[model samples]
Target: MADNRFEVPEYFKCPLSLEIMDDPVFLCTGSGHSFERNWLQKALDRNPFQDPITNIRYGDRLTFGPNRSLKAAIEDWKQKTNYHSASAQRPPSPPHRIPEPPRRPFGPFTPSLFPQPQFTPPPVLFAPSFFPPREPVAPPRRPRRHFIPCSPNRLPEHLLSRWEWLR
Candidate 1:
């Protein structure tokens, strides 16, 4: 489910309504400059160049116009929020493979536009290996060492000298 709450950027919000502004305008007050154009114009008509919150008076000299940058920021923010909300919904999956319709077997002598379907085994669901298991390889034999006794008489003549140090 998509998240219910989405926060609008403060910069994209109207100073008057405190909501996101679709058509933002700057009211030429040195105080809070951002306002939704139509909403503020109504306020401006009631009282000349006065900001209700900030009563600093510019009289008839107040200058204001569409806030393009703030509007663009609002558009970008809206796109991202909508994209995230859209992603929460599950996407459609590919169509399943439909089983072919059952048909009468063609007589051997019958001429047909479609070739006779060959019988193929239904696909293996559980088998992971495509090829058969290879024969188990026997490990190579290691050369065996002759067991010579520690006794002096049993020692080979060449090994007798080395065993003398042990004596």
Candidate 2:
């Protein structure tokens, strides 16, 4: 058995980096099985491409890397691909970029993306008649106060004196 090291085949090596491949592997229409991502990544990591922004490895197939020119790479790809009707078609529109709020606002804050108020129009406001007048609440009655008199003649003298002294 040969070395099992994660070595890619020579053909798979990216010209820019001349190393083993990394991410997405693109097959160029001009040359089948032209580019490999792992090789591109290794090449890019070791020594960034001269263009930096874009790196077009194979004929029409472009392996995008940081710093390389996107527009140039795309144009090159377009040329190499021969502008095949179906392949040349514009890519699908990306999903809506809904702006999410950093965090829910405490009160009265609305999201800009969705301008309309979330709350539905207060379900047609019903007249006071909608609800029966709360059973008429009777005015709370005031508690009655009464006074008890302690007559000096009715009390025993010592006891009354003690009571008076205690008071």
Candidate 3:
């Protein structure tokens, strides 16, 4: 069967994957082109650091900040058009299971044949009395020091003479 692709907006689609951007981000280049974060990261990892759209080298330090405006616009477009991704529309595959072998039934059902095991509750690890409650103790207060304020104009005669000599 031929795969039917959904008609996604060119701007909304990532340049690298050519699919709708799940987490769009700016390429941090002058062009300011946006691409899916994961796809861009994979491309950068495999190839040299550069802008996929413009094919411009960005050197070692390549940053891609989240394009919130573009993301919002894409979300708005999806809502307006009631668009769903191909992956989302595709039904999940059924899980694989090992088929059990058919068993022959016994002549008659008997409780004596298969005795039910008795269940015993586990012992409590922690008891209320194990930890006794105590009154909360307040933290120790630090000693306070009183400051003596002295104005530059109120200097003593001896200190003023020494200050002048130093100057």
Candidate 4:
């Protein structure tokens, strides 16, 4: 694995968003095109028989299906990144190396890559628990009864922690 962080596999990217695919779907149009479900649906509504990127016409009959394997891979990637982000105590492992799944010459689509001996659920932190049970919330800035208009407050661009300044 490379020393660089935020590295994502090429196949994991969504054609429409140009970002890592959140929910992959097989448009099954020309070349059996794949995209994020919402993105494809939006594009399909506009042009049912044509691919957005290639402009290749797939004819009138359009079909779409979920890319379960790709979706699972994406979710797994998300979990790993999130876990790495939250666990400051745990030393960062080497960058994740996702095993490549099978793919066509032009179309890169496959099912299982991280084939576990058996299915295993993600960790507890991947659940709704963001902060620890004992971690106290920061004090609210505004009074409950007061309404301040045009509060020129902006949220931190990245995770805000006391440790950020140390780096």
Candidate 5:
């Protein structure tokens, strides 16, 4: 036996009409509270039904939903508000990898197309002298430290000598 009772989900129930809707209208709003565009304009110009709140007639706004009035429409839209916001705030998925385009064949009239080189593992070489006996030498000793004393007054004399050389 087919279950025929209209046991719709709580979210499916239109907030405005409190009834099951068919082609529900979703409002893309800002701040998750206010509608972004002129709801009246989008409802009138883009919609097919008249504004329920304003009592204005619009052709494009009328969608194939169950709700009739604008208040009813807004009600249906409100139910999906949380869903729309969560989906919008979620990070976008990474792009899918597209298949590479087919390569054109090289003909006699065209220049010989060279195939891309493949990775080739080099042959490992071996030698009996690889592990040769080592004759180690001792490290050289450090040289004695040498310190030269200088005065601040000598700096100007050094600069003067360089200036005289320039002349």
Candidate 6:
């Protein structure tokens, strides 16, 4: 049964799966029908070289291609409708917060073996007048001649003139 929450277009669904196709494909059965690739593959696996809708036997000649237009249309529809899966639509479960263990105060009567260290604030340092202001560093320059030198022995007599300029 189809969910009544969002009114999905009739054409957006696969005829076999009755679900929105993630990867819609067109069967070359001359039926002008589109189906979800997964559903079509499953149908083909069961029947072997046959169209699920028309039940037309294609034998070894069975072929299909991605229904790009239909996929785009479905994506557009989903975006416009703000459609999300049932799992995504459902409210997230509340996170369980674990309570910290109660801390026992170490009084003079109950002396601890290890003493807690005192935290001191770090001192801030001002830049010295002797130091110059920081400047942006430029990247290393590349060699002007980027071409690789080819062996003279490998070059033809006619092409040697062009290769001479590279030297």
State which candidate has the highest lDDT. 6
lDDT of 5 by residue, 133-156 (tens): 788978999999964436444456
Comparison by lDDT, 1 against 2, better one:
1
RMSD to truth, every model: 21.5, 21.9, 18.5, 32.1, 22.4, 20.7
Error of 4 at 93 (Å): 32
**Model 2 alpha-carbon drift over 4 Å, by segment:** 1-7, 36-167
User: So what's the TM-score on candidate 3?
Assistant: 0.49
TM-score each candidate: 0.44, 0.18, 0.49, 0.43, 0.21, 0.49
In candidate 6, stretches whose alpha carbon ends up further than 4 angstroms from where it belongs are 1-5, 91-167
Q: Write the per-residue lDDT of candidate 4 for residues 28-133, one digit (tens) a residue.
A: 6546556878888888899888778778887575778999988898788868775242345578799989999767454246545555487788767665576568
Q: Candidate 2's residue-wise lDDT over 1-167, tens digit each? A: 76333333464345545543333344322233433455545554654532222433433323453322433444454456443333237787789898985775555665555566578666667887888878888999999986344765676666676568545
Alpha-carbon shift of residue 10 in model 2 (angstroms): 1.2
Q: How close is candidate 1 to the true structure, as a TM-score?
A: 0.44
The global C-alpha lDDT for each of the candidates, from Candidate 1 onward, is: 0.75, 0.48, 0.78, 0.70, 0.48, 0.83
Candidate 2 local lDDT, residue 18: 57
**Cα error of candidate 6 at position 25, Å:** 0.4
User: How many backbone clashes does every candidate have?
Assistant: 0, 13, 0, 0, 15, 0
lDDT of 1 by residue, 56-148 (tens): 777475667888898888788778777343335679778999999868667778777677798999988867686788999999999999886
Candidate 4 clashes between residue pairs 3 or more apart in a chain or in different chains: none
For candidate 1, what is the lDDT? 0.75
